[model samples]
Target: MAFFTRLFRPARASERRFSELVGPHIETMYRMAWHWTRNTHDAEDLVQDVLIRIVNRLDELEAADKPQPWLIRVLYYRYVDLYRRRQRSPVLPAEDCAETGFAAEAESSVMDKPDRLALAAQLERALTSLSDDHRDVVLMHDLEGFTTAEIAGVFGISEGTVKSRLHRAREKLKGKLHGSF
Candidate 1:
């Protein structure tokens, strides 16, 4: 409607100053953050902080037509900084993990206390015991549903490298899961 247009008609002058145009990109940003952070609370906080920065720097961006790379670059830097900060801080125990939906499963537990349940829990335990880099690859590729290409972009690596890393990670996970099986 004309009313909506009028409300958003203020900053449409510059190609890069289109601040109101970010509404459609929030989900993608959150997905990127989630892929990087792995933890739900950290992902949500990272997305919110990135959005605030984007809003403040909307007019400063050199490329408006394709903001994805720029946005993702910010996310990558933030994630790295967050990683460093986490290393310097005390880690929370699993029992102390906030109910931030990180460990929640919405599916019905049709295999309650079944052999499959024990094996699955053992596999999860195995995964939680992997190195940080190995865990990151699995989380980004398998858990967060990101393509190898997108992960390469996030990690500033080539798609081939991403695939190789993912393959190695999978091999390790397979061993752990098979050991439990």
Candidate 2:
């Protein structure tokens, strides 16, 4: 019995350590996934896929000094792969816009703040108009509060490229918003 217990103890310890490392970042992963997928179900699926990959590669990930960036990089790549696969598939007829429901909810919450709703709508339009790469940098750096260096790390690009993308994205956003207001 002691021998069996000793054999299982390391496995249990590793499981606990993996949980400790991953538990805190689940929400962050979900948020990033949500932004990429723009649908709750898809975002949840993406995060689950990421978590499964992380579990399978736990031995590899265990050695990283900071796992968050690495995990995010995994999430981003998974999303890109999924996006590519989706693009290759035959297109189905368009579904009703989910943003309508979100906008309705936002409208209800800000009944007394019409200006805020208009601003949010405008911003959403502006964001949607940008190319995916530009939107990603802007969302990660400006909305999600990731540093430029962190964004560079996640995208596996140089810091200067991240800065350039961010600058161009912001400039485009400014132009769009400037015209709207």
lDDT of all predictions: 0.63, 0.79
| Model 1, span 91-153: residue lDDT tens | 852432543232233113634646655555566566676776666667777865677777777
How large an RMSD does model 1 have?
Answer: 6.8
**Cα lDDT, model 1, residue 48:** 69
Indicate the worst ten consecutive residues by lDDT in candidate 1.
99-108
What's the lDDT of the predicted structure labeled candidate 1?
Answer: 0.63
| Model 1 spans > 4 angstroms off | 1-40, 56-73, 86-120
The TM-score leader among the candidates is: 2
